[model samples]
Structures are given as C-alpha cells and as structure tokens.
Target: MMYKAFFNALTGAALLALAGAAAADDLVLEDAWLRAVPPVSPTMAGYFTLRNDGDQAVELIGAKTDIAGMAMLHDTETTDDGQARMVHLSGITLEPGDEATFAPGGKHLMLMKVDTIPEAGESVEICLTFRDREDLCGDFPVRREAP
Candidate 1:
C-alpha cells in the first residue's frame, strides 16, 4: 500500500508540472491600444505586442474590429526619397520565443471607414486570426498618447 501511494503522488506531481509548462507556452498579448483620431478623420490606427512562447511558429493572417468598416495589417516603409508609405501585409510570421510589435511609424493595423470614434478610456474589441493557431481577441483601449 505504501508503494502504491508513492506512485500516485509522483503521478500527480508530474501532471501538475505538465500543466504549468503548457500554461507557460501559451501566446501572450501585451499593451494593446488604439490611437484616437479626430472625429473628421476617416481612419485610425491600432498597435500591440504579440509574444509567442510556444514551441511552434505562428502567423497572424488577419484582424477585425467592429469600430471600423475595414481593418488590415500594414507596414510603414521609407523610400529613398525620404518619403514614407504604408504597405499592406497579408500575414506576419513570428517564430517561437519571438515577439512582434505594432506601433506608430512601424508595423500597425489600419482602421478604415470608422463608423464612430471611441472616446479616450473606451475599449474596442479586436479579433486577430492566426494561420494555424486559435484566434485571439483583445480589448484595446483608445488613447491619445503613445503606448
């Protein structure tokens, strides 16, 4: 009976360790926020950081938000003439243990045809669809200042 009890305890401990590891491998979203545009502006921007801790790489394929009629991924590229332009991106790949950041003057989400502009301190739900992983939905706060 003592031997059986020891085996059971060891099994339980192993299971707990596995669970902890899985939790650590989960993807994490940090500092999600949207830039507040003027009421007359037709477009706004969204930014965030996506961290992947899992063993496999993932691709961000698309994004959607109710606040805008259309949402798309974009990258800001500077030309030789010192002019910057927005380039649309179909998807962004992030390797395991890597992170992607969306910020002003860099990679960002273009929110076009905004139906309404949320006031500062309000939150907008943005759903990010992945290529092979489950989608992640985050509530991004509207802020005038940089994140």
Candidate 2:
C-alpha cells in the first residue's frame, strides 16, 4: 500500500512537469545542439529528442528565437521525385505517454538567418508553441554546435 501511494505521487509530479515548459516538459533533450554552418547559409536546424510525458496528446505549433532572424517549425520530406526537401511545418501532434524526436530529417525547428555562429557550450533559447495553445509553451535551450 505504501509503495502504491508513492507511485501515485511520483506520477502526479510527472504530470505537473508536463504542465510546465514544453521542451523539457513532456520531452527531454538528448545531446541537443544547433548546427554549425557557413555565414552564407540561409538557415540552420536544431536537433533534440522530444519525449512525451502526458496521457493525452500534444502538438508543436510554432517557435521563436533571438539567435536568428526567424524561427519556425520544419520537416525534411522525401518528394515523389526521389529528392529530399525541407518543408516548413505549422505544428506536430504527439501521443500521450509517448515521445517524438525532433531531429535532422524529421520534425524540427527551422532557424533562419543566423547573425553569428554560436560557440560550443553556449545555449540558444527557443520557445515552442503548442496546438492547444493553452497549456503548452516550451522553452528550448540547446548547446551550440561544435567544430
């Protein structure tokens, strides 16, 4: 009986955590970092693991960042022509008690026009909006890219 009660309490805390920040809320970052690129690159992408922790569902709406001119949701899709292309996305849905990985060649955040190349060990702040737009607002911080 005591063990059961303890488990319940632990579950409740996890739920509350999901109720908080979006990025580290239900999801966790695994070796998360920004991509290093040339000054001429129009955009860069951040990669991380999005671990779902709730019992319902979640979606990624939009993103914001000061490190770049613009930050938005994006995906790498394979076209019928046998070519892979980068597509901007409005949002993403996640199953309750599950996780969705936001990484290269998958659902990810598109950061446009970086003014500076972020140094390693630095963290970039990003806010992820959710579909519900009510209980979902995640702030993502990733280590800067390495050489």
| Candidate of highest lDDT | 1
Best-performing candidate as measured by TM-score: 1
Off by over 4 Å in 2: 1-27, 79-81, 133-147
**N/CA/C clash count, model 2:** 3
For model 1, residues 74-118, the per-residue Cα lDDT tens digits are 999988999999999999888888899999999998899998888
- Every model's TM-score: 0.81, 0.66
Error of 2 at 125 (Å): 1.6
TM-score of 1: 0.81
